[model samples]
Every structure is written in structure tokens, then in C-alpha cells.
Target: MTAAALLLWRDFVRDPARRLWTEDSGCGEWGCCGSPLEARAFLEGVLRGMSRRRSRELRAVVDALDDAY
Candidate 1:
């Protein structure tokens, strides 16, 4: 996956999966299971798809929640 994400995929990020601590194969529907990064990526992608500005605002709110917690 690391090799494929880097040298092959050439999508989203420029670096490989090894370089991304948040990168996930996101293979869950198949019952293979996945990591938190995959879930995070999915949510983030959804947010960003709506609007990058809105996503940034949402992220700031999440950060504030963490800080308050």
C-alpha cells in the first residue's frame, strides 16, 4: 500500500502511505476492516467536498472542542 500510494496511485497526496500517518486504505465495506484514519478521511472529504472554508471552520470547532475537553 505504501508503495502503491506513492509510486502508483499518484492521487490526493504526493507522498506514499508510509509518509502519511493519516492515510488509510479505507477497506471497510468489504469487511476487511480499516483504521480511524480512513474514517477521518471520509468525514474530512465530505466536509471539504461541501466547501473548504466550511471544512476549515468545522476543524477549528473540533479543535476547540478538544481543547475545552
Candidate 2:
């Protein structure tokens, strides 16, 4: 993903209001996350599904985020 997109993900993960989705809640194209843990899982899944070159580029940042939580 682009740096700005990653930054947005990070911000979303850090936001305390990012909670479980409700029937009325509008989820985005990327889906919804109830917590940082779930968001990290989603990120890891994305990484695993991407090409090695792309995954490698973002692995460090993802790992760091994992460590933070």
C-alpha cells in the first residue's frame, strides 16, 4: 500500500472509537475492524495475499505496529 494509506490504517487502528461493527454501521470497501488486534490480522492477511515485493516493503511497518500493541 502507499505510505498515506498505511498512515491512515495506523491512525484507524490507534483510534479508540474504532469499535465492533453494528448492523447499521457503514463499513468501507476494506471492511470493518472492532479493535487493533482485528485490524492487525486484516493487515497481515493483506500482506500474505500480495506479491513478495510489495509485502516486503510493508512488512517492517506492519511488524512495528504489531510490536506496539
Candidate 3:
């Protein structure tokens, strides 16, 4: 990954609830919880969709998650 991507991954992998709050002040779903690896994968999928110019798809993927906030 590029330095930026790696950095973003690091930020995303840190405390998933905090990450959600950092993003949007949260809609309050982080307590639903998931494994760290799961959170990372979800974040990566969202990032990939965004990088590919697929924001709607990205939102769909993110929003579909119970832990997304």
C-alpha cells in the first residue's frame, strides 16, 4: 500500500468505535462490535470502493454493517 493508504489503515484499525466517532460523530452502532480483522476488512473494502469512485457502493457496504456508525 502507499504511505497514505497504510496510514489510513492504521487509523482505521485503531478502536473501531472511536474510528466511527472520528468519522461522523457516529450514528451509534460500534457497540455491536466485531473482530479487529473484520473491522480492518470492512474499512479496506470501503476505501477500495471510494478509491474506485464508488462512494454509493462504499456507503452501502459500510451501512450494511451492524457495527458501522
Candidate 4:
């Protein structure tokens, strides 16, 4: 799911017209992100909502991305 989200985010960044999907309902069924920041927030929200054991590695990646951003 993390890898898929990253790939979808990459595609969304390249083309804002594309829609991104998320299991987190807070992000919307198809995700209503209008900008990279919003998309990042959506991704982070989803990651944060996950169980600690499941999200540990993904949170690390997200932290790294946040630092780079």
C-alpha cells in the first residue's frame, strides 16, 4: 500500500488531472487532493491512521520525504 501510494502520488504530481485513491475515508473515496501538499497530507493521514506495527517503516519513509520536502 505504501509503494502503491507513492507511485500514485508520483503520477498525480506529474498530472494533477489524475485521481488518487485511498482506503482512508477522510481522504475521500477517490481522494480530493488538489495539490502536492494536500496529497502528501492525505498520504500522511492514512499512514498515521495505520497500526504502529504496520506503519513503522512507512512512517520512516514519510518522515524522510517530509525532511526532503
TM-score-based ranking: 4, 2, 1, 3
**All candidates' TM-scores?**
0.31, 0.49, 0.29, 0.51
lDDT of 3 by residue, 1-69 (tens): 333333333445444555444433434344332233445565666566565565666545444442443
TM-score attained by model 4: 0.51
**Root-mean-square deviation per candidate:** 11.9, 5.0, 11.2, 7.6
lDDT tens readout by residue for model 4, 3-53: 556654565555544345334423453334334555577788888789989
Model 1 CA deviation exceeding 4 Å by range = 1-34, 62-69
Candidate-wise lDDT, in order: 0.42, 0.60, 0.46, 0.60
On TM-score, the candidate that comes out on top is 4
Q: Any runs in candidate 3 off by more than 4 Å, and if so which? A: 1-31, 52-69
Q: What is the alpha-carbon lDDT of model 3 when measured against the actual structure?
A: 0.46
Residue runs of model 4 more than 4 Å from their true location after superposition? 1-5, 8-34
